[model samples]
Target: MTNDSPKPDDDAVRARVIEAADRLYYAYGVQAIGMDTLRTEAGVSLKRLYRLFPSKESILEQVLLHRHDMWNGLVERAIEGGEPRERLLAIYDMLARWFDEDDFRGCVFINCFGELGTTTPRVAEIVRTHKAGFQARLAELVAEAGGPQSLAPQLAILAEGAQTTAAIAGTNDAARQARQAAEVLIDAALGPATGTAQTRTSTTVTTARPAFRSRR
Candidate 1:
């Protein structure tokens, strides 16, 4: 006699592996972790793991996709109910929260790019796409706030620079410093704030709480 039970679907199994791989990759770096370790961490058979992700590159691709979703969600939450200028500044607020996480290491895309970008074209493309998406988002926010188009890239640079600085310096102060610089840039581009923008800036600068876990 054979006992029958429903097995988890491929999507569920794939998600589990991606999640486990994400944790290991972020903690140990992608090049350092091997398939056997992933099998143990994911609690799936080696054969099954190979079946789900034919190669390590395949798994890394899925991991980056998952991280993209998380990054988008974080930005959306940070800018949720604010006016255009407030929304622009809110990006830094979100960064401040992320920097404060105990496990924060830095931007995962940047990290992966440094590790495999030169040799791995696929990995390089993914990292570029993620960064481009962020720049586009900042452009939209700047336009909405009636600021010059040039201001968006400047703001993006600050955010990107802050991530690297905070990670290397082992301090969360980078975010606050970036936010302050952003205020000056925004004012320069769009002129002085007349209404609630001033109030929002002061409040957001002082009252950031932990928003999400850093995947990297």
Candidate 2:
């Protein structure tokens, strides 16, 4: 009893499902998209799709996790090497580029939390994990820059605020403002970089704030 039917590659099918899910989920809220639409968009048979992801909940979870990897990878690449202080500024610089993307939406976790956090405990946990990971990366950078780990949360606030404001206002200048504000915080915590700490007095500790401009 050999029935000849081409079986779909699991890896290929899974990638397609994730790709379609990412586009649709980000464009429309997760709840609004149905399995039929996903199957059609992914161009996979219903059985195959089911085999890859048993339910919409499974697909949504995978999609969020996939995006977390991608988003974090981009940030890591942006801050890969350079002055620790400059790496801090580069966080906002990277955001400016992301904001300019045609498909730019606010932070994916933030959007997901708003839509599903109350109803879905899994979704809430995913969002919390992503946010914690984000802040942890910031903490690493801050510590390397000779700033206290305590400044990481404050910097994360500025970054999140800038991201939200940019999404609403449709401008990247928010990142620039955030970067400028970050400079003040970093200087306050780390003191002057070029000179000795003894050279810095209480009145001269703060550096001159410059007009913010988008670099990338």
Candidate 3:
């Protein structure tokens, strides 16, 4: 009997590998999942896997990049239909919903950084890139809301803190709490409410250095 299995094309193989890697790497830390297991899960031959990804590190980098794209898409879709202010709040709302997902495992980038960042240069770089991209998105939303650029970084920190707290405490309240804090920050940064009678400062105000300690 002759073997008649059709060879998988590069696109199909790449998708399979990334799909498997995303699932496995996110669930079981990067260091724990080996290439052999990825091969089995992806249903790709060892030779094919190597041909697609020269090494495990390369696959890990690709997985992180894939995750960054996925995360950005999720946030953008959630906020796309909302007003400028709504767009900022939409981020927290999305996080709250995500926290309730059955397989919620903190953040893939955060988790991977905690687990393998010290040893994996590519992982560390990917983590930084992911975070920088998120901050950039938040900054865009802040500017859209007539908020000062200085406030964007602060809001981003609150968002990150909320995720870390929610994941560690296994509670759904962090997003709400963060959202509340974000509203206060956004309001202060933007100025008094239109309905409320109050004197407004005409001169530009500069923010002092952030008091929050570094999480790094």
lDDT top scorer: 1
lDDT of 1 at 178: 97
Candidate 2 backbone collisions, by pair: none
Cα error of candidate 1 at position 192, Å: 1.9
What's the best-to-worst order under lDDT?
Answer: 1, 2, 3
Instruction: State the lDDT of candidate 1 residue by residue for 14-108, as single tens digits.
Output: 78899999999998899999999999998889987887777898889888888888998888788877677788899999999998998899999
In candidate 2, stretches whose alpha carbon ends up further than 4 angstroms from where it belongs are: 1-8, 193-216
By TM-score: ranked, best first = 1, 2, 3
Overall local distance difference test of candidate 1: 0.83
**lDDT for each of the candidates?**
0.83, 0.78, 0.77
What is the TM-score of each predicted model, taking all chains together? 0.86, 0.84, 0.82
Query: Pairs clashing in candidate 1?
Result: none
Candidate 3 Cα outliers beyond 4 Å, as residue runs: 1-8, 192-216
lDDT (tens digit, per residue) of candidate 2 on 1-216: 222233546678788899999999888878899999999999988877776676787887888878877877788778766677777788999999999999988887888888999998888887887788788778777766667888999999999999889989998999999999988988899875663332211111111211222211
User: What clash pairs does model 3 have?
Assistant: none
Candidate 3 CA-lDDT value = 0.77
